[model samples]
Target chain A: MSAAVLVTAVSDNPLEDNPLEQEKVSLLALVGELDYTNAERLQHDLQEAIGPEVCNLVIDLTDLSFCDSTGIQVFLTIRKITQDRGGSIALTNLQPRLEKLFHLTGLAPAFGIQPTVIDALKVFRARQSSS
Target chain B: MTGDHGQQWPIDEDLTALRERLFQHAAQAGMRGERLDDLLLAVNEAVINVLEHGGGDGTLSISQDDTYLTVDVTDAAGHLDVRHIPRKRPTGTVRGFGLWLMSQLCDEFTIQRIAGRSRVRLRMLLHRSPTGAASPDSVSGDPGPDESWARSEVRSSPANGAGAHVDITHSGGTAPSPQQS
Candidate 1:
């Protein structure tokens, strides 16, 4: 009985989500590419999306596949801006490698990188509830 | 066409200018991930350490040689612990993370306690298209702080401090990595 088949996983997508009507958490889901190619746009988008009223900003990276210095700068810049505005920021669905980078750099404790959007939501809710 | 090489702008802002120039060069050289951000932030921190800690004026040299874009900061902050980190986090210890962040950014980073002075050197590979860092030079010298890299001062938030985190992901960026391990 010869019965065996092989399977391979293929994904060309840049891990991201479509722009949904962000509420409760005010999502700023970045799609396309997030490296130097579009990092400036990412920074601009981030700054524009954030306002004094926005207390919670959830950046969904489930669809992202790449990141460069510009992208990192955007994150750093936005994070600073968010703090200055007295708001909370969280990350959801970060890839494993990205997760490791965060941990190794001692940034894990500063940013909430959750496995899923649902998990991020929980963390955000808990923070809100307590504060 | 004269040859006088001493004061090229006031020594005060030179470090910040040097940092920005190198950052642009590194970005152009295609250094990625924590390396780029880490280099920029760490350079500033290190330079400020020189200024605030050592209270000395210095010049930093940055060049993109064949395999790596080198940063050599020659400053007077030789007395401080260039490589040591407090094992236990005492509340409000600001001096540690500047050097700490520098360590995490470069592939081949060194803090050499050279003759009479210190030389902090940072080497990041000339990666083809950004996104990932190349392998580190195994023979990295003083892991604490290169006895030499180079210096500058800039205005901004304390990079390693402030306790803020923002999510980052590259969308349709440049040349994707050859391997995804």
Candidate 2:
């Protein structure tokens, strides 16, 4: 059977009343495999997750066991979208294999990668305070 | 050690199973860690190409010798233009990196057309100890610029005169350094 990729929107936190938080960040987690068979689905899900009101995003890839060129493309597309909207996206908990891929393709510095979701959120928080 | 053995499987949507099988063989051959992951990823990309661009159905055959592990993915359809395989796509482009990635990961990659069938062959050198005791001069290591295995083309005479011919073409020369990308 063809391997399927699972995408889940874990949480969307607006932090409306908090003085320290300026933007709503949504967390999405990808699991299983990502390849040509499910690349389009991932693109759609990412777009749906990053609506107008929800800009800052964190994608948790700790559970993603497999990813291919198509998966990389989805990440690139989302990065473009986030940049165009004056928002940012960070990735957390990348498997070593996935990390190798980004390194090989010369994209390691393009994505904001963190060791944990909280660290990723800190990145956004830092950016907000600096701006 | 077993005089070179091979196994074949029909192409299907079960990429996970295919990857698992390839991993099993690589592990059996004493490949581990990053090297094993590279082998699996290269083969996975090639097989996916066969299923998507070639006919929906194809076959994957894997064989190994003492020095090299090889995989051949064949499809019934032919006439694939292997000359212009791109080494890299424009930055931020999504769909064109499969072939390039496969080339980067394998020691040698070739495409051949025989009797209306197209086969993509990928070869990776087996790992050896740092001491180079396994094969001495045959110690498999990172590909270098002067390596002749970078690229070549071969043509064989038709078999049986039934319009069956083999035209083999190598992929591009050594991949650019990762920094070039």
Candidate 3:
């Protein structure tokens, strides 16, 4: 009955060994509920995907049905790590429930939130272009 | 849900089974959308607190009436200190959201420790009465005469967190202040 958190890498870069050859952006889609039981797993997956070269992280929560305080803690941890490395974390495709949670926790301003994955990517692209 | 008078589930070290049961029961009780999610999150957080800090195991008893659903989580460890309950959500730290979030999601939240066992009670308004107001009787945790099943589930022990006595009750609006602390 444990909720599964599936972290799928959506980026096209196939470079396995060379960090310089890989794209700087990492797009990860989180599927399933991220709660106390699976929050640590999701954090591990996200951390593993975010290497030194991958600064910008885009997380698609399209298929996520449930999240609690534990999930939020993990997201905050990842956001802090990403920000410290001069990268940004964007959350896309949030369900209305999650949006309400973000709003209630007063954490909506802590991360980049977009309506769609394309929009999230555009935000990262815009940030990159400006720099 | 309301169909079951007083269903009791054991809160184990692995909360997966308990969580699934609670989710399905809540969904069956007509809670939908954000309200349902809120209830689940609040209850899950309470259960997590029990497992993490309240001697590693507890009992979750769910009971409902026409206008409200009530969940009572009881654990042998009476570790909750009313004074330590955060009045506001903590900032710059990620670990303190459980109790605060539970308070924010439920219409009525209470923590009580009598003797040695601790009980965290959560009540969510199911719907407004026909007069467009919540039923007044729903405010009381007093179970009806016939619904004694939930009351029977609570057991007390003298050795678990002995001498700790606390009664912290919070009722009314569930919204926290707009500003984070």
Best by TM-score: 3
Native-to-model Cα distance after best TM-score fit, residue A13 in candidate 2, in Å: 8.0
| Residue-level lDDT for B153 in candidate 3 | 20
Q: Measured with DockQ on alpha carbons, how good is candidate 1?
A: 0.04
- The window of 10 residues in a row where model 2 chain B has the poorest summed lDDT is B155-164
Q: Against the true two-chain complex, what DockQ does each candidate achieve?
A: 0.04, 0.40, 0.41
Chain B TM-score of candidate number 1 = 0.56
In model 1, the runs with Cα more than 4 Å from the true position are A1-102, A105-107, A110-131, B1-16, B27-34, B81-94, B127-181
**If you assessed candidate 3 against the hidden native complex, which CAPRI class would it receive?**
acceptable
Give model 1's docking category: incorrect
Model 3 pairs in collision: none
Q: Best to worst by lDDT, what's the order? A: 3, 2, 1
Q: Per-residue CA lDDT of candidate 1, range B1-181, in tens? A: 0012111221243443555566677777787655566566556555655555555665566665445666766565466433242222222333354454455545545554445556556656665323243335533444333223332111112242222122112222232231211
| TM-scores for every candidate against the unseen true structure | 0.43, 0.76, 0.78
List candidate 3 stretches off by more than 4 Å: A1-3, A12-23, B1-4, B129-133, B136-181
Clashing pairs in 2: A1-B14, A2-B13
Residues B1-181, candidate 2: write the lDDT tens digits.
1125888888887778788899998788778887678777778888777777787778888887767787888887764435434544336554547766665565566666656877777776674445322456665565433233324322212221112122334454444342444
| lDDT per residue (tens digit) for residues B70-139 in model 3 | 8888888987633334565567665567776666666666666656877787776677456434668865
User: How many angstroms is residue A111 displaced in model 1 relative to the true structure, after the best TM-score fit?
Assistant: 5.0
